[model samples]
Target: MISCSPAEPVVPKEGGGNRERGAAPRWILADFDDTLAPGDSHAGLLRYILRRRIWPLLLLPVIALGGVVYLVPSQRRRGISLIWWAITLGLSPLGWRKLVRAYCHTRPGLFREAHRLLEEEGHRCWVLSASPRALVRAQLALQRPANLPYRTIGSRMHYRLGGLMPRFYCHGQHKLLPEICALDTELALSDSLHDLPLLGLGEQGWLINPTPARLEKARARLPHLMVKNWQL
Candidate 1:
């Protein structure tokens, strides 16, 4: 609903990916959860927090409430926020990055091809994730080569509402705000239908490990959508 100025654009590096000489660099947007990493970062974050706490059971009611609220389409965002608050209730910002990084180190697996694509300089890849910003960065640092020439944008995990609310949700069509539109998108990669707004942007679309039904729905609108596989 509100307009924002575009972000500082990323200059393309020559000899990147597979582009012909003088060809425009392809712009790519990829999801983090279930796309790059097989596990959901938010779920992993909550699990990490719960295991460290003395009595995680105290947080159960709030978490349950969030799950119930999340079933309602209109209240899903707030529901997720409430669940985040519950997990982060007593956790301070201090040493959180270390914790997040530590958690990433223990993650099961990342899709090698997806991670490789992000590292490629031929195309400009932007990791547009719904996961918390710091969490995504921590995960990326463990896997991504340093200065591989890519960008990451993620949800703002503000501590407001007792850590329940976000400054920017960065989910669904909200990912297509002015700041993102500033970049030229030639491809999109995601697992969820919620990202149809972003997937619609480019000529090429990739469905990361989608179910048959979901793939069918996506192909209905994006005939160019190609399936990318990552097995658990």
Candidate 2:
């Protein structure tokens, strides 16, 4: 596991970060897996469920189906959902959410920078992920009793194919966020190159989990990028 803290970046003086209470919320976006946290949530959940139950093995065929379906570029979300449905056969809506919450509580380590952003005042930061919304919300709940505030947008659970599956996942670079479409983004943070479009929305952007060579490449293009170290 890697231990990391946020690198302080220069924020423009007019908006975002530690602003007045009751003021209109400043928007920010954060990626979860491989950005704020280290790994893939869906994969993690599968392993978690597998260790506790025999069901995942019984549903291996479904995962195979998902694997085949995942080959198509546009149907990836649907493919992933099929795999999830198989892994989560026994859980109802509430049960699934409780499991997600429990999984998040058990795995509490996140990049220190993630906490700093949450604690800052006046920003209505939204943690965005391709992971399910429940997974995102559960992790945010772990920061409760303190922190500035938080919101989440991820793959939403909708009843489809006779089970609760992710209906709309935030995947590609141009994924639309209707909630913040009208507002000005103060900052954007993500690890993937696909998110450059989203990063452009913010006045400032932080690319998380960059390799040293990759960071150098980015700095060559944009010299002012901030830095933080991680202990692997």
Model 2, residue 184: what's the lDDT?
60
Least well predicted 10-residue stretch by lDDT in candidate 2: 1-10
Q: For residues 132-193, what per-residue lDDT tens digits would candidate 2 score against the true structure?
A: 77776676667544563466778777776555677786774424465545556777777765
Best by lDDT: 1
TM-score of each: 0.82, 0.76
- Residue pairs clashing in model 1 are 16-122, 17-122
| Segments in model 1 whose C-alpha atoms lie over 4 Å from true places | 1-24, 147-149, 161-165
Of the candidates shown, which would achieve the greatest TM-score relative to the real structure?
Answer: 1
Q: Candidate 1's C-alpha lDDT?
A: 0.72
| Residue 18 local lDDT, model 1 | 65
